[model samples]
Target: MPRKPRTSNISRSDYYDITFYLQHYACFHCRKAFKQSFDNQRTQRLCPQCRQPMTNMGTDFKAPAQKEVAQWRKVQSLAQAGIKFFPQWPDGRPGERPDTLAEIPAFLKQVHPPSEGEQMLERRSQEPQRPQTPREGKLSLQGFAPHQTFRLSGKMLITGDGVQVFHNEGWVNAEVSGHGNNPKQPSHLRTFKLVGNKLYYAETVPLDGTLRLRWPAT
Candidate 1:
């Protein structure tokens, strides 16, 4: 019972030079979420089970149970829409997340407006222009300018330069080739070759039934 247990009055931050914050990374496909110390230099985090890139759900994310498919799907949709679970809104209020799948569309619309491609297409449609040739039969590359983005289908968003494809997970390097009528269907299809021998066929027309050809907004 000596005086050997004297406590220091130093603050925690002053004692520990480097503070490490925890961040949650979720793999929706695996229905798993784990925490890792935040590393500013680290760019990508891969799931331990699936080896797929994990979504950074931020510090406030609480993972749903593995059996809760609907809940997981909602979370996945939010992640795909580039929404992260933060503790507080930008205005300092507590975050309010949608509870059901049906409410997600309205919530997303309120938080995130139409994407860049949609706005660009809308603006172009308003402008006076001549009717152009339909791209249903040809493979002309004129519409695909550099740095533009187009929604190839519900599951795929491709860059105009044919360099990358953004799916539910994230953007991946891809090669777009063999543009023409799909052999299996009457619609036009664009072949996309992903990094790991994964081939995807996306319709030239987007899910909204619009074929974007105008330049994207900068």
Candidate 2:
């Protein structure tokens, strides 16, 4: 039998730590950080554009330079990853992908385990989740006609620092949310994982802020 690859320790920065790691760190695969580090194993991450996931090749993974790591770094304001994802391509789940390198410590603040100090399970038991509440949010559209049906077709592309949305109708300043291409739900209610150049997420739960999501660009 072959021996499993050695799981290496990931020296963490303050920004990317999560409760999963007592020290707090995200899994290269899930983009969801962990407290416990996996012994040099592979993992996966979801990409917003193609609606496909990427992976991390543990063998070649290494700490990058400050400038290089800057790409994966979390912008304080826009909430996007400064670094890239691992695996380089799409082998689907639990495999090679790009590096989701940077994040703010606040982003993963809610992910800690429950032990009286962290409150992972305790929080879950306390609060049941519901869908997004309709706050008095504003929608500034460039060419979006009210009640129009525009499909991203499971393929939405966003670039640049400022927010720019291109719906089937036209472009505007807005973000996305959902679980990717499921034709069942109404497009508006489908719940997409957002995309932006300086994007960052506050939580994991698809519907509400249970995973308290955000991408504030600094």
Candidate 3:
């Protein structure tokens, strides 16, 4: 056999570099946080206790104590508004998030402007309620097909194929799969994981009139 090259001759770059760092995934509803390791920050995780989707608070996030209900509420508001507690803002500015609840409104205004969907909702709220026609009763996914994507309440997106879901931004993948109606209750749609042919990591979304699910034009 031919002599092999010495291991010392190999450079560090020659090997595949997979560096994992611990990031915080928080469940605002549960008021708990968990640390998970991933090579990047875009990974979505679920709450172990509630099995509901959790928000990725990034590496620099320092979670408030569980007993701090008011602070947790503030954090929850920020997270739901698509704000991540990264070391820097999306615009590359150093993070200077509000420490007090009173300052949060102004800080959020400076950072995140009202999205189009939000503005529409606000305008609709200001408008007087009109009588509902037959077509405006309840939203339905009756004719939806596989691989087609639909937006949920302007915040989450789900494919009709039920294989993938994205929360807030499309690039951030929410790993839970399986989107369909609960067999026993057809009034609600559910996103879940199927493990060993049984339901796991499930979250139910009620098909109430308050939530709007629409297929966006491609």
Clashes of 3: 0
Model 2: per-residue Cα lDDT over 107-181, one tens digit each: 344332236745666677689775453222222222222222222322221221122333334333334433335
- lDDT score for residue 216 of model 3: 29
Q: What number of clashing residue pairs does each candidate have, in the order they appear? A: 0, 62, 0
Task: Give a tens-digit lDDT track for model 1, residues 169-195.
Answer: 544333333333322122232435454
Q: Write the per-residue lDDT of candidate 3 for residues 1-218, one digit (tens) a residue.
A: 98998666432211111234566788987998888766344445678999888877766678899999888888877776677655443664426767877777877877877899987998999999874422211233332343333334343333232322323333111222334443222343455556797865465554433443333222
Q: What clash pairs does model 1 have?
A: none
* Per-model TM-score on C-alpha atoms: 0.42, 0.15, 0.40
The best candidate by lDDT is: 1
Considering lDDT, which of the candidate structures 1 and 2 is the better prediction for this target?
1
As a whole number from 0 to 100, the lDDT of residue 24 in candidate 1 is: 76
- Give the least accurate 10-residue stretch of model 3, judged by summed lDDT: 10-19
Candidate with the larger TM-score of 1 and 3: 1
> In model 3, what lDDT does residue 204 have?
57
Give the distance in Å from residue 119's predicted Cα in candidate 3 to where it truly belongs.
9.9
Off by over 4 Å in 2: 1-57, 60-66, 69-107, 119-218
- Pick the winner on TM-score between candidates 2 and 3: 3
Instruction: State the C-alpha lDDT per candidate.
Output: 0.57, 0.32, 0.56
